[model samples]
Target chain A: MSIGQETVLEANEARVVYNEDSDNPVEAVRSISLDLRKGEVLALVGPSGCGKTTLFNAIAGLIPLQGGRVSVGGIEVEKASGHVGYMLQKDLLLPWRSVIDNVTLGLEVRGKPKGEAKKIAQELIERYGLGGFEHSKPSGLSGGMRQRVALMRTLAFEPEVILLDEPFSALDFQTRILLQSDVKRIIREEGKSVILITHDIGEAISMANRIVVLTNRPATVKTVHEVPWGDEVTDPVAVRDRPEYQEMFSTIWQELELTNGQQGKTMKGAA
Target chain B: MAMATDIGEAKKQTAAPPAPKRRPRNSTGRLRIMAYQVAVLIAIVAVWQIGLWTGTLKPYVYGTPWGVMQAFAEQIANGTLLRHFWVTGQEVIIGFVIGCSLGSLCGLMLWLSPLWAKILHPYMIALNGVPKIALAPLIIVWFGLGMESKIAIAAIITFIVAFLQAYKGTQEVDQDLIRLMKSLGATQWQTFRKIVMPGSVPWIVSALRLNVGFALIGAVVGEYISAEEGLGYMVYYAGQLYDLDSVWVGIFSLMFMALILEAVVARIEKMLDMEK
Candidate 1:
C-alpha cells in the first residue's frame, strides 16, 4: 500500500507515564516509535490502560510526552494546527445545539465565519446521511446517528490526520459493525490518514492496514501485524461475516489473551 | 444477569402474550394512599381549629389558618403587599441573575485557566466558609440599608454556590471530547465554548436553582438586619408587634416564591434533558 506522504505523522522513542496522588507514577507506554503515513490506517489495540490512549494523547498534545518526540506532517506535535481530527467514544454533542451546529463546532471554533462553515457542515451531514438530522438535538438521535454527527464534527476541520479513540466501542455489535463501515468509507472518501484505537482485534483487522498491539501498562509494542485484508472498498461488516474474518479474530484474540494473562500482574509492579 | 437469561428463556417459552390481559392492581392502593394524605391534613387543621376555639393556644404564639389567610387578604387589599413583594422579589431576581452569571463566569474562567483556578480555589473555599449571614451586617454597612445591600448579600450567597458547581462540572469534562476539540486545533476559549460550557450546563443550572434559594435567604436575612421594606422586614416587625398572622403571611409568601423558583429551575432541567 502506498501512503500519500512518507511520514505524515511520526513518533520517535515516545514514552508516557501517569502519576496519581503519589510520587510513584505508572509508565503507561514505554518507548513507542511508529510512523503514520498519509491516507493509511493504523490501529492500536491492547488491554485497558495499556497506553494506547496515552499515545494518542501524546500525539495530539493533550498530554506531555515523558520521553521522545512526535511530529505531524513535518510539524512538531505541539504545533500541529488543524492537522488531526479526533472521534471520541461517547460522541459528546452539545445538547442545546442542533446537529448542524454540533458538526460545525470545530470550524466555528477555528473562526470559519458561521455561514460558510455551516454550509460545509450541512453538506457533510447530508452527504453522510444526516440531512434531516441537521436541526435535531443529540437527544433526538439514535446512537448510530449521534456517532455520525460526531464523525462529521471531527471532519469539519479537514484535518490532515485523524484519530479515532474507539469511536464504535459504545455501540452494540450490529450498529458497531455498520458504523465501522460508514466511518471507513467516509475517511477513505475524504482521503484522510487515520489512527484507530480499539481493544477489538476484529475491528483492527477489518479497518486498519497496520495493527499495533501493546502489552499491559508500562507498555511497549508487543507486536505489529501488517494485516492484508483483501480489498479497501469491500464492506467491513460483510468482511466480518466471512470465515476468513473469524480466523483473524481468533488468532488476534489468542495473542491478546496470552499477553494479558501473563503480564496482567506485572503492570502494578511497573507502576 | 440471571434475570436477562430468564427473560430470554421466557421469550422462547412463549412467542407472544395476550395483550396484557391484566392491568396493574395498585389503583385501589393508590387511592388509599391519597385518602391517608387527606386524612392527615384534615387532622392537623382540626387540631389547630380546636386549639383556637378552646383557647388552648395563645394568639401570639402561632396564627390559625383562618387568621393567616385574613392577614394575607388584608395586606393584598391595602396594596402594601405589592410594595413588599416588589422589594423582596427585586432582591431575589437581581441577586439570582447577577450571582449565577458571575459564578458561572468565574467557574468557566477557572476551568479555562488552571493557574487562576489554583490561585482562587482556596480563597473561594475560605470565602464559602466565612458565613454570609455574618457578612449581612457588613453588606449593609458597605452598601447601606437599601436594596443594594440586600442585593449584594444575596448575589454573594448565590454566586458561591454556582461557582463551586460549575468548577466541579468543568473538571468532570470528558477527556475524549477535549481530545476531539484539540485535534481540530481549537484554542482554549473555543474548547470551553464548544466542549466545557455545554458539558457544564446541567451543573450550572443545578447551581442556579440552589443559589436561588440562597439568594432569597441572603436578601431576607440582609433585610432582617436593616430594611424599611420587603417581606423580611414585615415579618420581623410583625414579630416585634406580636402579630403572628402577618408573620405567617410573609413566611408563606417567601415559601411560595421559592416554589416558583424551584418550578422554573425544574422546567429548565427538563428542557435541557430533552434537548440532550
Candidate 2:
C-alpha cells in the first residue's frame, strides 16, 4: 500500500473478539486492515454474520480491538470520539429534545454556547428539509424523517469522519432510497469521510468509492472492489439499479458465497 | 400504581403537547379529586356514625367525622391547634428538604458507582421492604427525638425510594443515544451531563413528587414516637385523651399539608420541564 493518500480513518490489522464470560468466546472479527481516504465513502459489504458491525465497532471504539490499531485523522482512537459521528439503525433522536436541540447535542457537550450551535443546526435542518420540524419532538416524525434528523445531528458536529451502522436499515424500501440520496448529497457538499456498514451489496456498489468485502465471523478483508461509478453516480437508487451494480454485487457474493452458506443454515435453524 | 396513573390521566383531559408540553395531573387532579376523596371519607364516617347510633360500633374504635370536626373546633378555640400545627409544619418542611436532598444525592451516588451499587443494592432493597416504623426507634436511639432524628428518619424513607428510581432512570438512558454521542467523541462526563442527566429528568421529577409523601410520613411518624409538639404528637395526645375529634383534625391537617407540598414540588417539576 502506498499510504500516500489523505487517509481519514485507518484500521491496521484490526482484530475484535467477543469476550463472552462463557468458556467458548467467539471471535467477532479477525485481522482486518483498511484505509478510508478523506472525502470518500468506504462501504463494508458482507453476509449476515460477516462481522461488518464488529469491524465498525472496532473502528468507532465501541468495542476494544484485540489486535492492531484504528486511527482517525492520524491520531489513535482507543475510544469512540466526537471526531466521528455514528448514525445508528434508528435515528436515536433524543425524544425529549426538539429536532434542533438533538442536532446541537454534540456541540452542547463540547461547551459551544447554545445560541451559535442552534443557528448552525437550524440552517442544516432547513437546508436538508427538516425546516418546519425543528421545534418538533422525534415522536412527531416518520421513520425516514427521523433518520434525516439523525443525519442532521451527525452532520451538525462537523466531524472529520462519520460511521454509519446500517443507518437506513430500519426504514422501508422507498424511504431508504430518498434518505440515502439526501445523505449522499450532504456528504459530498460537506466533504467529510464516511465508513458505511451495510450488508446490502447494492448499497455498497452505488455509493462507495471502494467496497470492502468480508468473511463471516472472524472476518478479515476478502477483497476491495475499486468501484467504477465514483464520477458517474448521482442518484443513489438510480445507481443502485445500474447494470454495473448487479455485476459488483455478484463479484462480492461469489467471494462470501461459502460463509453465506453456513450463515443461511444457522439462521434457518434459529428462525 | 396503575390506578394512580389512570386517575392522574383521567383528570387532565386538556393538557397540551404541541411542543413536548409536559402534562401534569393538576397536582393530584384538582379539588374535584379531593371532593371524590372527601366523599369516600364521608361514606366511611357515615358507616361509623351509624355504628355509633346503633351501638354496634364502639366510639373508641371509630370516631365520626362530625365528632372529629367538633374536637377540631375545641382545639381551635383553645389555641393548642395553632401551636402543634406550626411545629408539625416546621418539622415536615425541614425533614422534607433534608430527606429529598439526601435521597436525590444517594441516588446519584449509587448510579455513578456500580461497585458500591452491587454491594449496597440488596441492603437498599431490604431496607425499603422493612417497615420504616420498625427502624423509628433505632433512629430515635441514634439521633434522639430532636428534629435531627425526625429528619434522619424521613431521609431514610425518602432516600431508598428516590435512589432506586433515580438509579434505574440513569441506567434506563437510551443505549443508541449514548453510542451516537460516543461516536461523536463526547467524553464520559459529557454523555452523562447532556444525555444521561436530561434523560433522567422526568424520572427524577416523578420520584421527587413521590418522595414528598414519604418524607412527610417519615416526619409525622417520627414525631408520633416522642415529640414535644407536632401534628403527629397532637394526634397521639388526642387519642390518649379520648378526644377523637382532635385526633381527626390532626389527620386532616396532615392530608392538607401533603397536598400543598405536592402542588409546590409538581409546579417546580413543570418549570424544569423545558429540558424536553
Candidate 3:
C-alpha cells in the first residue's frame, strides 16, 4: 500500500434513501466513504442485501446520493460520466446485436463515428480472444463467454475507473474461478483502477489490493484490510497460494457474521 | 484463499459442439392426416349433393355445390366478380395501411411522457370499448356512400387494436435495459431508438396480424350498410334476388382475400425477423 499513489476516485459521506418522499423512508446507505488509488483494485465485500448495490449505484451515478458526494479523478461523478465504465451482474447485452455491435455500444452512445467505433471494437474483440465471434448474438454464447464479452465492452471505452457489480456471481463455480483470474490479469495489464463489489470473501482476498468490509443496510464501511501481496503479485491464482490468504479470508468472514448478528439484535429489539 | 487448495485444479476441457437438431420428417404421418382431412371434406360434400338430388334439402334455400360453382363461372365470364373483388381489395389495402401506421406511431410516441400516457389511458379504453361496427352508418354519412366510407370504417376498426397492443409493448420493455443505456451515457432518444423500439417490434407485428381480420371486417360491414361495389354489396344484391349460389360465391371470395392478406403479413414478419 503506497500512500504516495494518486487517488483516482473518492466518495465522502455518501448516503442513499429509497422512497425518500414516503412516510416510511428506507435508508439504504448511511455516511459511507472510501478512496481508490490509481491502478489499484479495491473490493467492497459485505453480507447479502447489505445495500452494497445501492452504494455501487451511487458511485456509478445511476442514482443520486441523498447526501455527500462521489467524484472520479477530481471531477464530480455526474460530470465525470464517461470516465467510469460499469459492468453489471447480468451481461445485459442487446440480444439483437452482434458481438462487435454489443462491444461498441458505449462508444456509439458517446457519439463516436460508426467506422471508428467498429475499428476500436474489432481490435478489442481480437485482443480478447473473441475474434471469430464478431457476428454471433449474445444468446448463442455460454455464460463465461458472455461475461468476458461484457468486460471487453467496458474496456473498449478505456475509462480511467471501472465498476464491477457482482460480475461473476451468475457463473458456475469453476467458471467463476477461471474468470476471476482472467479478469484480474486483464485489469492489471490495462492499468485501470477498479471497484469490485462481491459477497465472496475468497474472491475479495484473491483480487483486491485492499478490501473494504461493509455492514448491513444503512451500509457504512466497517473495516478495511490491505492485502499482503499488494501489486507485487498480479495473478489471482498466485494470490490464493499465499499463506496469509486463508487468514485474511476467515477474518473477513467473521466480520461479515458480526454484521448479521447486529442486524438480528436490531430485529429482536423491534419485535 | 489458500484453504481452497483445489479451486483451479480442474483440467482444461473444451465442451463438445451441440448436436445438430434433426427436423422431424414425418411425411408418412402427415400424409395419413391429410388423407383423413380430405375424406371428411368429401363426405360432407357428397352428403350435401345427395340430399339435394333426393329432395331431402330444399334447393331454393340450400343451393347445390354445382350450382354455386356455376355461379362463380358465370360471374368470371361477365367480369362482374373481378371488378367487385378489386374494389374490396383496394379498400382493405388502403385502410389497413393508414390505420396501422397512424396507430402504431401514436402508441409508441406515448412512451415519451408518463403523464401524457396516464391522462389519455381511460379515454383510449373507453373508445376501444365502443363497438366499431355500430359506427358504420355514421361513418357512411360522414365519408359518403362510396368506397371512402368503407375505407374509413376499416381504418377505424383496425386502429384501436394496433394502438393498444403497441402501447402495452412500449410499457413492457425491460427497465434494466434502459438503466444500462443511461449508464453508458446514452441520451433519452438513444434509449428509445436502441432499446424501446426494437423491444416493441414483436408486439407491433402481432398487432398487424390481428388487425388483418379487423380490416376485412370493417370493409365488409361498411359495404353492408351502403355501397355500389365490393364483395359485401355483391352478397347483399344476391340475397335480395334470392340468388343463394351467388351469395356463396361472394362469401368464399372474401375468405380467399383473408388468406392472401394473412400470407402477406407473414412474409413481412419474416423480413423483419431477418433484420434481427
| Best lDDT among the predictions, by candidate number | 3
Docking tier of model 3: it is: acceptable
Instruction: Choose 2 or 3, whichever is better by DockQ.
Output: 2
Which one is best on DockQ? 2
Query: How would you order the candidates by TM-score, starting with the best?
Result: 3, 2, 1
Chain B TM (all candidates) = 0.81, 0.78, 0.86
In model 3, what lDDT does residue A253 have? 92
Winning candidate number (TM-score): 3
Write down the TM-score for model 3.
0.89
Interface RMSD of each: 2.5, 1.8, 1.8
Off by over 4 Å in 1: A1-6, A17-25, A229-233, A240-247, A264-271, B1-47, B69-79, B257-276
Taking all chains together, the TM-score of candidate 1 against the true structure is: 0.82
Which regions in candidate 2 have their CA more than 4 angstroms from the true location? A1-5, A20-25, A247-257, A264-271, B1-60
lDDT over C-alpha atoms for residue A238 of model 3: 80
The weakest ten consecutive residues by lDDT in model 3 chain A span A77-86
Worst 10-residue lDDT window for candidate 2 chain A reads: A1-10
Write one digit per residue (lDDT tens) for candidate 1, span A1-271: 3457577889898888778446998888889888887778899889887778778878878778878899887888774366677777888887778999888888887789989998999899879988787888788799999999988988888877888999998999999989998988888788778999998888898888788887777778888877655345357766677776777787778878988887755657787
What value does the lDDT take at residue A14 in candidate 1?
A: 88
Query: How far off is residue B165 in model 2, in Å?
Result: 2.5
Candidate that beats the other on DockQ, 1 or 2, i.e. the better one? 2
**Which residue pairs overlap in candidate 1's backbone?**
A139-B276
Model 1 agreement with the true structure over B60-122: per-residue lDDT tens digits: 697888898899899999988879988999999999999999988887778777777666655
